[model samples]
Target: MCGIVTAISTDNVVPVLLEGLRKLEYRGYDSAGLAVLHEDSLVRVRSAGRVAELATMAASRHLTGNIGIAHTRWATHGEPSERNAHPHVSAGLAVVHNGIIENYEAIRERLTAKGFVFESETDTETIAHLVRDKLNAGQPLLEAVRLTANELEGAYAIGVISEADPFTAVVARKGSPLLLGVGERGIYAASDTSALLQVTRKVVYLEDGDVAELKLTGYRIFRPDGSPVERTVTVSSLSADAVELGQYRHYMQKEIFEQPQALGNTLEMIAGGNTISPQVFGAHAGDVLGATRRVLIIACGTSFHAGLVARYWLESIAGIPCAVEIASEYRYRVSVADPETLVVVISQSGETADTLAALKHAKQLGMDKTLAICNVPESAIVRETALRFITRAGPEIGVASTKAFTTQLAALALLTLALAKINDRLTADDENTYLTALRHLPVAVTKVLELEPEIEQWAQRFASKQHALFLGRGRHWPIAMEGALKLKEISYIHAESYAAGELKHGPLALVDRDMPVIAVAPADELLEKLKSNLQEVRARGGELYVFADAGSEIPESDGVHILHMPEHYGMLSPVLHVIPLQLLSYHAALVKGTDVDKPRNLAKSVTVE
Candidate 1:
């Protein structure tokens, strides 16, 4: 995935483009570049590092223009270098692009034979040349871009600046995210809202296969049929201050602490009721849930773990057959999908590439019932789904998710209750119990945050360990997986999770005195069986680090350590149990002196495969 922005203004657009690139750098920061139309030429400058380097380079070279395109890349087709950087200019056309062009190789060969000289090894470069070639054949700038788009075969959001059109930059999206920001001073297009938050709050989200031309004072959008289209300019509620890391050392920690408020915002709709209303999902939620015969949850990364936990809740509480799959794998494999199945896609950013692909794949299989539980309002997943629940976990800047995961679980719990009501499986008493638990959830998570000091001490112990094994049973198993993922992601430790029952199934051999075994010991029905499985590790001399509920009786002895939860939250225990794991990973990564926010080789949003 890469970040792109196109802007034209009466004021010099260089500073706006540079600031936009800085904000979008979290998408990818391997390289950064921008191309601006100055007088009669496209002046391009690129650097092979963070956006700061690009800014320094441009400053030294005095690169200036009023109309421009910018990009911060996460390399997919080529290495991250100055030559491979974006703003690939050719034949008077300067282009910055996000997403992959799958048909690049074949198109490249055809164009090479046509005597078009190539410079860098990039799928994006091919797009630049294709537009350049079309323009060289006397096509107007907009027509050349339309011709170039018709020749492409893959997901992409492109920004094009032509020397011929000094005041206009064209942008397009197909299976990738793009949006336009309208301002009194100028018009802007970007891969995400963060890039335009400072410039304007009014935005128009572009649909797939849509193209637009941003001009100095206005913009126009066109459908795939070349007909002009109008889009609503929703005033985005996001503020510039929400994205800043105030006192927190890292974005992950800030997000972790934001769980209570984020979750409260997510639960606000259902807070006053005794039972969940399907209206919380969408206006047609009740009709969709009432007809759903089964559910298929698709997601990637931490969102996948949230879906796994939802599987247990849906099957156990709602009496629905639920299955969870990694979106990347699910997209490649053949599967039995029915029209009655509710295909649920979970994502924090709503722009996850593989998850969006899987959502489309399910639709291709004739599954009409779709729901997206996501954080961002105008994300691709939410836009494509028939029904959607927007989680209010605003602006998760950390590469590793914290508040978003907890809020997903909260939304999924509401889904469970709503589905149960639809199936007549929920009793009045049980509904009241769940509603009360949800109302108290924010307070519960607040208390869980209090355990950080104790958990950090445990984290100090884990800093020296090279490997870790995590265990849980039943619904809590997914919590174990999330715990391991957090540890490995930020701490740079080798960690793996196994169902407690599966310890005997070959994974038990990895247990040793030097390796710590972390267990999610909630006082559920599986506690006794999970304890028996833990004995296997204890017998193998594996040091134990158990996050047990207040009453869970998982003892602390010589080699066994027990960090007691303040209370037992029953089905909601996963939300509480995970907080400590997050704290442990955060503190352990701190001790290890690793990059906690931008972990190695990972982007905040995986918008590319």
Candidate 2:
């Protein structure tokens, strides 16, 4: 995962480049760099830290140019350092690349035989040298870039700039995301639309094997075989203010609090209706769901956790057999495919590499009933699937996801209700009951937000803990896993989650006063079983912090702490129970002085393998 922004403009673009980098820092912040063609020379600058550091260095060097390319890297091939940063330069050509160059070693050997030397340990440097070699062999700038791209293998999105051709920039995409922004004064290219929203909303999403040339006033697109192609320019629907951290101390905190609004926006379609129709997913959703016999869900990271929760709802409510698989592992393994199974892929960005590949693999195995639940409508996964549900969570700028996860759960609940109705498993009264709960979900989440001050108090004690164990039963088991993930992601604490029934098998061995035990104790069928698991922890002298339903009669004792939720929320209890855990991780990170928005060794979107 990385970010790339390049532009050819009539005026100095240093400010635009830096601002774009700042907006894209969530994609990566390991290192940042830029290269500009100015006064018949290529000028490059780089830093080993955040984009703000690069901005400071650019100001000190007084770097200015009308045509430039900038990058914030995620450090795939080499360690994070100034030498391994992007905008790798060679001769008069400079290149900024995203994704891996799989055959770089052989290409590097061939270039070395030709007496070409490399300066960085990144796969991107080979691209600059190859393009420079092509230009030296009498190929024009555009042809040199296209020829160099043909010689390369593996997924990549690249932007090139040359001193010899100072007014134009060349770009190409194979797998990783890249787009062109048609602006009033310039033509721009970036990995994400968020980077160019300030200047222009008109964007052209590039297809695989497509190359483009950008100039001050116009642009051209070409296929890999040199045939000119046409691509539609779409106006982006995202507002620029959505990415800004307004009044909040960190993007993570803002996203965490935005859950109520996000859920309301996502569930707006079923507001006044007494039942959820299958058509809410898409026009063809009725046909697909009616024929589906089983379900298969594929995802990674936070999306994977959402799918795990859906498995519980799908089997229990819809009376359907469902399987949730980790995308990275599922794609490589040889598994039997059932055509009657509906393949559901969930992603926030819709461009996750492993999940997209897994969807393609399922298609190759003759599973054609594909559906995508995602936030971005134009993302590759949504485009490839037959049916889709677009979540209205807006832009999630934090590396650790908050609003996106909650909105996904809300969407999955709708899907469960729709499938249950189609299978005749849901009664009229049952439909009305579930729909009423969905309508009041936003208000329920608002009530949960009021518990933040209490959660922060718990975080003050949690910050000193080095290890933690989280326990839950039934459907809330995945929520416990998510809570553990958030704690380690931002606060850097060691955390583990287990189903309450599995505690006696193994994880109970690590319990002691030094390790805190957190439990999600909802007032449900498994409440008594979960309470017994808590006693096992108390017997081991483990400190206890439990988020229980208001009706639960659990009281705070010497080593036991209890924070009551506003209500039980019935089937939606998992969604309400997760909010306090999110606040706990956020405040703990705040107390520990860790970067909450951009956590270490993590990116907001996983676009690369």
Off by over 4 Å in 2: none
Predicted structure 2, TM vs. truth? 0.99
Clashes of each: 0, 0
lDDT against the true structure, per candidate, is 0.90, 0.92
lDDT of 1 by residue, 364-457 (tens): 9999899999999888899889999999999988888999999999999999999998999999999999999988999999998998998889
Instruction: Report the C-alpha lDDT of model 2 over 130-196, residue by residue, as the tens digit.
Output: 9999999999899999998998898899999998899889999987899999999999999999999
lDDT of 2 at 521: 95
Instruction: Provide TM-scores for the models.
Output: 0.97, 0.99
Candidate closest to the true structure, highest TM-score = 2
